[model samples]
Target chain A: MSAALHRIDTLAPRAEASGTHIAIAGLTKTYKTRGGSVPSLKPIDLNISKGEFVAIVGPSGCGKSTLLKLVAGLLPATTGTITIGGVKVTQPPDGVGMVFQSPVLLPWRTVRDNVLLQVEMRGRPVAAYREAAARLLHTAGLDGFEERFPWELSGGMQQRAAICRALVHDPEVLLMDEPFGALDAMTREKMNAELQRIWYETRKTVLLITHSIPEAVFLADRVVVMSSRPGSIEAVYDIDLPRPRDLSVMGEGRFVRYTQEIRKHFFAQGDLDH
Target chain B: MTDTLLVQSTRANVLSKLMSMDAIRPLILVAVILVGWDLAVRLLRIPPYLIPAPTLVIEQVIAQWPMLLRETMPTLTATLGGFALSALVGIPLAMLIASSKTVESYLYPLLVFSQSVPKIAVAPLFVVWFGFGVLPKIISAFLLGVFPVVVSTVLAFKSVDKEMIDLARSMRAGGLRTFIRIRLPHALPGIFSGLKVAITLAVVGAVVGEFVGSNSGIGYVLQVANGNFDLPLMFAALFVLSMMGVILFMALDAIEHFLIPWHASRRPDPNSGT
Candidate 1:
């Protein structure tokens, strides 16, 4: 397995020069529940390039999230290895950031103070990051709401603040697990565009997990589809499209075709046309 | 949408609210209570020793101001001293328990046991151990006050959202950083609740110690007054005790407000704030 992964590492020098950020080799995960040890993700290998926005999509209960967690080091990989920035991930990397599906901002903290939390926790001076945090908040369209508590904001606004918090630390890798899944459809689309813009502006590598086929097609440079329960990589589809894509692109034929192709792999080989 | 009408209506609403803020209902209720008390005292002619009239208690309080102040000093000292000690010890212990499950499990039952013991009954032991000096009263106050602090600190510590901790970890925050930045701030309200309850109990505990054995304090005055059948003086001492409790509690509350201006409990009601 090491020899096989070494071949991939040999490919890494060429890719590294071209900016490859994370490389996963035969990554597998299992959970030791009360009943028994249950496998979550089957052994699978994949690589996410630097500055790339990749989305993992599958049905509910699929291990797409598990894959993200494994890479994030929230959980340990049972029988495989994950490398970020050419280093094996044994724990949550210092340069990795995560955004959950829920806007998990501390309710007691004001919006600005909440963003500064990451910096403060890192023992970094808040003075150094204060302007940067403010800038990020403004980028998320939360300019004047810095002093507002989480409860004072609407759901969409709170989630936006959460995103700002994730980016405030300026991590090399951003792991997002259905960050906009809880938002309304209109807000979700808006948030998606905002996220894309942020990703483009920051040029940070992002690994987003979602169950939405269209969402995957819209945001990802490549869409990695997984099978349900005991999940493994079914296929990886490269979304060959232009940068800074508009929401109107979804109405175009190419977008629909990519979404259809991804959906076909997500469902079992059956009446996929239906 | 019309500017003039909107401004006029808003102003009218504010004016109407202000007008209704008069304490008519509360004043009437106080008046009715006083009348009922006076009527009950006059008709039933209950012993002044058992249930002294409000008038007599007030007169006693005014006349015995010099003696009361002399008593107030010692009692207030023990209450404040014990409360301060509890805050210092209990908060850190709460932090320790909150940070570790092992600490919580081991100490939680002991904390419960500490509160379960009848505080008044244990006052004599404090006197025996510490002598009939201020030490016993202070220890009594400390014992009573510490429980609320521990309970509150534990509650505050536990109430910190798991998501926030994860957020901090993903941001590369170390354990100490997480506590200072996230957990401690999250636990403030609960800690304050404990502090408030502890302050009130501190007075009770101090008095209990005085009751058992003391050369000074309002509790000693009460005992002496009771022996001589000086009902009015006893009532005055009791009134002073109640006033001291109120004053201490308010002082703590004020400190809380000053320290954590953003606390929800500290925020005045928007509708009621004049």
Candidate 2:
């Protein structure tokens, strides 16, 4: 590690080593569309540990993305509080990085420039993060593509670029909304493996929102399952798997067993308690 | 291997041949138009004073170059100057409108209503209000051009993927940062579309202003030509006006290509791959 990076790493209050990276308390979000006021997400509470890879999984339209958005402060909470690394998030909080399913890269910018977008917006000198960004891109297997445009790359390659862009600022927390949902099965699996490697390397707190049970099992230290629309957490499971997990591990009994367990919970019926 | 090389060369030759072949139909269309116009003038024995031949129109355009420039300058100034103003005012307004539903609700309907009224019919009113010379012409052109830009810009800003904004927020980007980094780039294509539509309309608006109450300009020249029954000069001025619109639109298209070459729509062809 460079002396400057070492200094930055120590100088900034350790976001991950702190007790919690993100804390959502009594969170609720309502949407007032022309159709009517639709409560997108009901009251919910979640706490994610520092440096942990947590995956939130639910059925489509069940508000997993909304939950993540609320945590990111992209959507204002109708009535609740969200704190990230000890800071209250009324608006978007700094030191948080994000990645989306579709890459969403600026078509005009080259890969390097796209990655530098965070710095540009923050009005930070690119020089401060250029080396770190280059290293992240290399780790993401995107070394030769710095000059390429998003359209020139494959779907997987663009997603890797998006991840690099998200992490270029060396953020404290990373929020991902089905970042690999658009890729083919094979590419998605490869990306899961790559993401695991990146998580191990950076130790940045990651909150991934995905619908795929297997993906959640493969990448996360903890899997958070949410209920249907007007969503809330149904269950949370600790993976207890070893790091540097191989693709072959995906075929192993332990991985399959965990995935099946999560799938069962996701589809389990709710009794008419009300 | 040798056979493969020969086949590839043959494919290249065939591709070039196909491109040239594609031009044939458009070329034929242009030839037919010219021949039809020439024949119609000759066979009908149309008086040059009423409907000049194509050759006479060209000759008059060239011979009256000084007069054309003198007449064209004011109109061009109004069209271009008003276009610049509209872009400046409309883009920021659209951004503001796009950012808030309340702004859009209040302003968008007003904008639509303003644009619905016939600009030509309102040109005399502008002349009455702003007076003749350049102010009325510029104001009329601005009024006509600004609407398309504002509408397209609003749509463009609205059309940005919500996921992208969430991604930025997850990365801890503030509203201004998100706007500058993500939303602005996404809105460029839309803004350019509006600009192109507005630019063409600007010329018509300038002419309308001139027609209503102008001491000088190509519209005034056209009026004089019509009054004197000089069809050649009228045809000449009309041709020049159309050329101006074409040139302006082409210029904007070129700018779009240069600025956002990675846009899928901007990609030339899969065959070129450049």
Candidate 2's residue-wise lDDT over B38-70, tens digit each?
Answer: 899999998897678888998999998899988
Error of model 1, residue B117, in angstroms: 2.0
lDDT of 1 by residue, B39-139 (tens): 88778997898877878878999999998999989999999999999999988888788778998899889888888999888888987888988998988
DockQ of 2: 0.47
Q: Against the unseen true structure, what C-alpha lDDT does each candidate score? A: 0.83, 0.83
DockQ, all models = 0.46, 0.47
**What are the chain B TM-scores of all models?**
0.86, 0.87
**lDDT tens digits, residue span A142-221, model 2:** 98999988888999999999899888888988989999888999999999989998888899989999988889988987
* Candidate 1 pairs with clashing backbones: none
Off by over 4 Å in 1: A1-19, A124-131, A264-274, B1-32, B267-274
Off by over 4 Å in 2: A1-47, A76-89, A229-232, A270-274, B1-29, B43-50, B125-132, B258-262, B271-274
Each candidate's fnat: 0.71, 0.79
| Cα error of candidate 2 at position A201, Å | 2.2
